[model samples]
Target: MALTTGQHSWWRPLAGTALVLMATAVMTVMLASGTEIAGELANRPLDSEGTATWGDIGDTALALLSIAFAIPAVLLAAHCVQHRPMGTVSSVESRLRWRWLAICLALALPLVLFTVAVQALMPAPAGKSGDLAWAGTPAFLTGLATVWLLVPFQAAAEEYAFRGWLLQAVGAWCRSPWMAITPQALLFATAHGWGTVWGFTDLVVFGVVTGWLTIRTGGLEAAIALHILNNLVSMSIATAFAGAFASDDTAADMDWAAVAIDVPMVLLYATAVLWVTRRRERANGTDVPGGPNTSPPPPTPQTAAASRPTGYMDPAAEA
Candidate 1:
């Protein structure tokens, strides 16, 4: 379901984008500053790169939560500026499809696990330390807890901003999904900051894949599912190993080897989710109809009358 139609005006997307950016900037700064203060108080100041080390649970939460703030920022922009149901930013249906999200998540789990398994078997890069040491029970549990708790929201917030709000904003102005999807994909990659050429390209590929999936499957569920699982798996490994958290690496820092593995995994997920979406649509004999974009079956006369407000009179009846 595309956000191509509605009470859309050419300027709404521009206004909404500005609002989202301003709000996100404000919230991120507030939360990040607070985290920095807490870190200083605990004698665990952030490194030069502003990254938290292993066992620095407070700072880690702050970092993730800063990005998480984008969720409300986008929703607020959609509702207040776009003059549409806040849920519309979620999907064409104006709300999340819980079952569909769950299904996508299940589809993603195996592929992500397989990718992780393969990566585990691959040789480490030449400059990488192969030293193996556990991060102790307390540190590991705390880090894992933080990652699991906040990573989903962090991932979802990104989807809502780039794929949801930005995509819809552009789609409102242009009928072409490519027009809507491509800019956001490029922006999403840029937001990660630059690292290796392979890593940057890989991220762009991810954004494009997910953006297409959001339109094809009629929601952000598929993209969100893949992102959540991928992050959880990667961070869980980092949490388990001593000194892993001390590194300032992000997905943007990935090398060619990592990109080769990641790009294919995302493609596999997109293909599988599309196949399922098509199958479900064929079975129902229509587009998966849950959002405002899909027309619902007409109500029966009696049902319609019963559903009307008490003492309300239809114009036709009155005449």
Candidate 2:
């Protein structure tokens, strides 16, 4: 939101958005091409997919890294066009709040695990094989290793682009938070590519929820945590189930049943995170922005005092 608060011409955000798109495209292509060249030289043949899939370590890593290019692209656009610190795209605090991010990650793990359990208990879609086999130990280990290493950055790149960059870009022109939030949510859903109507709606809901959480928390940490965990779990499951990744199914392909489960899981996470943030603010005696659920905890008293101008005296102390 601070990106929107600065004094600049109206065209700045528009220009920044344009730069982001161009930069993302160029960077992704170059990165993907580089990966392919490296793969060829290594005799591995890494072909980047149009969409992210879990077929193999090479393909999976390519998909993630291709998308991950958005981070530097967005950051560059923010700095060059908006004249703001790259970190401001991360949070109103101008940098990642590691403690808050960790808290959200902790809150997300159980809920995601519970969702996976529920999915496991549910019947498989009709006509789709319910049977699953172990991907051989070596392949499985390699897949898992790739996921753990790249999925977090891949997921964070998305949050940085959507909830972080796009949201703030829109915010720069629009005074209303929803005005900023809605466009990015819709765009996020669209980026996943359309499948079933239910799945599309579900993706939209995910965007909206995560976008709102980004605003509520005054940072992308909440959204990023949820996304990273969701991708990690989903990809891990696919890796565990032999041949599952060969199929082209994505979140966009989810049926109503999947949507029903996913929608509520994200909502629950958002609610619980909000509660935790509120509790943190209260415990720290920090000013809560917006309302009870708002974020980027205000400076502590000692921090506040230390930040005051030289020789400045506190009126309360003088009294």
Residues 126-176 of candidate 1 have per-residue lDDT tens digits of 888778799899889989999999999999999999988888777665546
TM-score, one value per model: 0.86, 0.84
Clashing pairs in 1: 1-218, 93-291, 93-292
Which segments of model 2 are wrong by more than 4 Å? Answer: 1-7, 39-55, 288-319
Off by over 4 Å in 1: 1-6, 36-55, 289-319
Error of 2 at 35 (Å): 3.5
Q: How does residue 213 of candidate 1 score in lDDT?
A: 87
Model 2 over residues 149-177: C-alpha lDDT tens digits?
99999999999888887877776555466
Clashing pairs in 2: none
